[model samples]
Target: MTLDLIYSTALLLALSALYEFNIRAWGQRLFAAQVCAGLIFGAICIFGMLHPANLAPGVIFDARSVILGVAGIFGGPVVAVIAGLMAGAYRLWLGGAGALVGAAVVTTSVLFGLGMRVALRRGWAQPRLLDFLMFGAMLHIAALGWFLLLPMQHLQKLLETLAFPYLFVLTPSTALLALLLNDLQEQRHAKQALARSEAMRRAITRASPDLLFVLDEDGRYLEVVSPEEHLLYRPLTETLGKRMDETLPPAEARRFQDFLLQTLKAGTPQKIEYELDTLGGRHVFEGRSQALDIRVDGKRAVVFVARDITERVKAEQDRRVAAVAFESRQAMLVSDAGTVILRVNQAFVDLMGYSREEMIGRKTSTLRSGRHDAAFYEAMWESVRKTGKWEGEIWDQRKGGDLVPLWTTITAVRDAHGAVTHYVATMNDISERKLQEEEIRSIAFYDPLTALPNRRLLLERLQRALTLARRNGQHGALLFVDVDNFKQINDEHGHHAGDLLLQEIGSRLGRVVRESDTVARIGGDEFVLVLEHLNEDPALARTEARQIAAKALLTMARPYDLEGLVYHASGSIGIAMFNQAEVDLDLLMRQADEAMYQAKHAGKNTVHMHGG
Candidate 1:
């Protein structure tokens, strides 16, 4: 083969390979269309080679424009430009005048491809028929410009034979085809979006905690979504499509129907409270209805959405009833201004042993025991007004002129603006508890045998005396005394004789000490004396301690005549003085105990100072 023929064959093969590569790179769907177009064009070129005709010399058809436009509209502009370059190179290798025509085809194809890509990216192309027409017009204009650059004689023949038909007939037909394809794709996407939205709505309705139902204007149930269907004692599927009266009791159905009708008539929304007698007993519901303009059988109709608020409604009713009963039956009272009683229940009158005529319009102070002063009332009211409630024990006076104790709670009622409206007081009688408390106090602090101060009481009085002496720059004394040989009387003459001797000693000490002093029996044979208001002289404390110790020892030495028995006792005394040197009660007590040990160690029946 000659060099020219070899170049033409190589060029044809190269174009075919380039087209295949573009197709594969873009995807099989796009590549298939371009390959099909190329096959058809190649067959036409072979047919022209076999049967050549001598006719008017002009460009008969421009397959380049057709292929490029198709690629641009379908696979986009980049593919078209690639195809155009391959076509131009193949025609040039053929070494004919058609090469120039091929160059024009290449230029027009690139412009059409790039322009369409820009328009599409910018959203300038409409999605419908207008987009098709605009795109076709742009391609034809590019083709016309390419044809103008051709030789004059050939261009004139092309306009007459090829340009008119391609612009007016072929371009519009191609646009119509593209439009149909777009419409199909849009329909598919719309169907998918609608399906997703419907599935989401169904999921939400099924999982809701409340009983949700849709009703028509005539009160027929269209749908019901409820998790607690067993509580209603009816399958939700069975209840659907039935009238409200058919599925519900007559009374409940009537109330629901009325609410729906009212909502439809008003063209707005309404709420109605009603009760349902289901298998779970009485369940309350607050039915809320809103008018919905829904399409049924291609005609407009109203639908209502009713939600069950059974738990909330029942709780509200129970609270209201309990509040009213509590205010009416219990010993409830309300104060209007600054503890002034404005209202009192009959239970309060009976509890305080007072008539209603005597209690109303009276200040709370009328019941006060005078044990707590005005500051006590102020503190109680402060807590009530701040926190709205206070509860504890309180003391008051009864109508019969006796003090009564009660466990009382006071609460402040406030208005919407947060201003105090009234004070509510509730109380229960606790007089018996107060009496028991007093008896326990006496037992804890006093000695039952001697009717005098016990250890606990003595410690308290001694601490007080020390504090007074420190404040006044005076002195006090604590004397710890023990009977020296009282155990012998119990061992020799029996325990009865020892008890008689101790009683006699206690009597003698009480007679010797002043009324202000405290004489305490800490044990069977031990006693403590707390003497206050002493002179600053240390000798005075010692002198008083010695005098008490002498009186106790002398009283014990005399024989106790108990049921014809004789008993004698002596006492060793330890004295501790409280002055400016002593800082606390514990240290003073320790000093007194040490002194008593020293007295016992020195000898029997003697007194010892803490320093001595």
Candidate 2:
């Protein structure tokens, strides 16, 4: 019985080793692990029963209760139920006087283990050495009660002989199994915690925008982690274990090594600005370094974080250039898309006579002169919107309430999406240019002495009148007037008297004709008049010309006072009428001149009609 008991106890210990090293290594699925544990526990229980410490024929005792009970305590309800049914069914199938008793013992041991598990979970009992020992003791005590089912003759002998051995061997085995399971639970928890911490570290490094590096005291790259790989000096695999002098220019590498040594000696954080020609392009970087407490490859190390500032540096340079250009001599103003003034250069302030503070935040319409109506501004802005530019003359008011004409060009500033973001306007004061242009127009198309249309202007109006006469079926007349004895008056009263007589004659001719007619001084003493929109008939047009000629002849015969000297001058007039645009312009002028000569031959201070 002692040797059989050793064999049974040794089998259960082997099962305990399998549970420790083999079953638990299947990993962390609790239900699947417990089901596998249940199958193993049931198999161990059957093997133990087959080699039981036999007291009598068809009556047995071994470690079946120990296996099922431990499965209940550690594997919870699933393992306990599965293992108990298997062992209990096998025991009942082995028809014997102890079969019922063995089955009852199986149920009682399983129930006690499950009850203790509930105690541990609810904090009614702690899973300590004392609790597990007491649990094993109490479970065996209950299993002893199932021995009453044995035949009364065998039951007393079995209890007296085997009860002590069951308690001695299986109780400590149960406690040892619980201790093993507890240790495995702690190990699993620690491994999961370490895995989660490692995953978090990797996630943070992958998401960082800057390049992270570990460099040894000798300036060799120990490790590199770059989220933007293109910004790196080289690929990570090629860069590791490479010295700074191998990747950078000699001067730059020396500067970097000096800063690294300084950081390590100080044992504190250091900062630097540097440049590197990288895979992408030349880049400017700002680096921050902290000395590490550990070593890499037997040398002290540092954690260096580099942030690329290439675009930022370029933008700063561009901003400085734009600042200088914006303060130029040309008057320039910038406004938002809503026409609210944003910025104005010094030249703009001087030109508009408004202080920068007064103009900023105010609408551009605040400087409007009101000479242009709303429709004019709308058209100007429409051109700017469609073509992105508008240039014309505009009148803007000064601070003193005087209108200043500006030759202004407005250009729309747009963003990358082609949306107008602001408007930049350049202006030049054109007041002096306007005055010069008016003087030029007077000299080009008008007589300087009399301020009347000159011969050049007269011919243009005569051609236009001819065009109107043909279109409207109207006849136009041209009158040629001559000062009678004008050369004799000039020889008697000097040239000043002749000039005054010509000026008075020009005024008198204007009064005798309609406003639409053209009166011009073509030569020294000759004048021509063009009347438009006259009667359609030839005789009626001649009568109209005769009446106007008679009026002008009488007015010119009136005396003129030349510098306090009363001077008398008379005029002879001739008329030529035409109703067709096909009439030759030079031929028509000759006809009027011939008629005037005939008038002079007829009598002085009289009028004559051509072909009369």
Candidate 3:
């Protein structure tokens, strides 16, 4: 019988692997998977019986109970019934006096195994080695009890020859296989679950945009994970296991080493910003570090995330400088390459007696004063074209049609390509002072040229609006407005007249927006509108921003009586819609600027919306 069951343990181990291979499919149809396993093992059990070493002419012995009992315990009632049928039917077909007893053994062992399985489900008990030993003994006893189905002589012969071996060897082997198979299944599942967890962690890390690192308190790199490899100053192999002092420059190394230690000590995150000379060139990086639940080389571990913020810092500095310039006493106007006034100071508004909006997009001729002859104006522009600057005294007409004398300087701003991208014109009043102190106070937070909020004030107000909108879950709009063909006025009518046109455009923008909104001059013919307290629905809010833009378009399109010349002008408007909680203000401004260029490309006098 032992020879007949040769390598049965090996077969059982192989079945453990089979169960694991189809574990997912089994999860969906556990009963079916179980029934299939039962049928396969049951057939193998039948083969084991067929090949059993004969103990007598009519009686036989094999480990059929091992297959049937295990199938029942692991697979439940359905598996038990199927496996019992195969084992019992094959035994009965063998046609011997002991066949009935053989069938009985298979059936009873299945029932015992099923009882334990149901008990496990009910939480009454857990499987124990002693219980399996008891179960194996009981199955043999059941088979022995049916010995009456054998002839008296056959039963006596079987008992004397095989009873001791069956009890000591077969029963113990059955119990051991059952316990071993159960452990194998559990271990396989544990490994599978662990694999899934690791995959999920890797997926999350891969999805992040920031540069990530794991390091020890001693500033040794443990791991580096990043979507953009160029941001890393050192290659992966070079950084891993290397100290910061070895991988980075002295200053940066010290900064990072201290940062990691501080993070470990605080047990909370710390933020820092530093610059690096990477393969991609110099970049400013903002980093935040948090202590991790780990230690390496007897040191606490920290997780650090770094993001590039070079462009953001540069843009902020530029805004601050522009803000300071707008707060100055000189009436200043900044125009883009398209000749549209992009910003202005409040002095221009007070000097011209026009609200900042009125003269924003009007031709420079609007303030011509008719003092300088056509030849004189041509010479001024020609000189600016060649020298990038022209400074002189001139007469400018105000909103009330009064001519005021002023000293002015116009400078051309060029990009790296040596192409003129902007013009900055500053005016210093030469006439007698009038309300000078009051003027200074009035223009404190306003552009001296347009009486609109200066850069500093506009940013504060915008930040507040954004916060309010976020709290209320509402929307806001930012517009970057450029006057189209504005340089034509400066070239033909004079810089003074171009300033007048800008004033007109600015005034019209103010008229079209809601009272709660803001219209401000950045410089030149460029204006910005902060439309606030808008609808929560994105589509509705977008429509409202567009409606206001259309109104500005129509209003600015009307002929302007710049010194009664009746000049026609238009606007190129770019709009960026945002929610307070989500938008970065710098990115929002860039979106608007990009949209404005889109409008310029689409033909001026139209509006363009930017996608976030």
Top candidate on lDDT is: 2
Task: Report every candidate's CA lDDT.
Answer: 0.67, 0.86, 0.80
Best-performing candidate as measured by TM-score = 2
- How should the candidates be ordered by lDDT, best one leading? 2, 3, 1
Better of 2 and 3 by lDDT: 2
The segments of candidate 2 whose C-alpha lies over 4 angstroms from its true place after superposition are: 1-209, 227-230, 234-237, 265-268, 365-387, 390-395, 458-612
- Candidates' TM-scores? 0.48, 0.71, 0.46
- Candidate 2 C-alpha lDDT tens digits along 464-551: 9988888898999989999888898788889988888888889888888999999999888889999888888878888888888988
Which run of 10 residues does model 1 get worst, by summed lDDT? Answer: 47-56
> Could you give candidate 1's per-residue lDDT for residues 89-198 as a string of tens digits?
55555434445755676567556655665776688766566666767776776667765766777677666655665566436543654564355445545765787888
Which stretches in model 1 have alpha-carbon errors above 4 Å? 1-131, 147-157, 185-189, 227-233, 277-282, 298-300, 314-432, 440-547, 551-612
Model 3 ranges off by over 4 Å:
1-36, 50-55, 75-86, 134-171, 216-218, 263-271, 281-284, 290-301, 307-612
Which candidate, 2 or 3, would have the higher TM-score against the true structure? Answer: 2
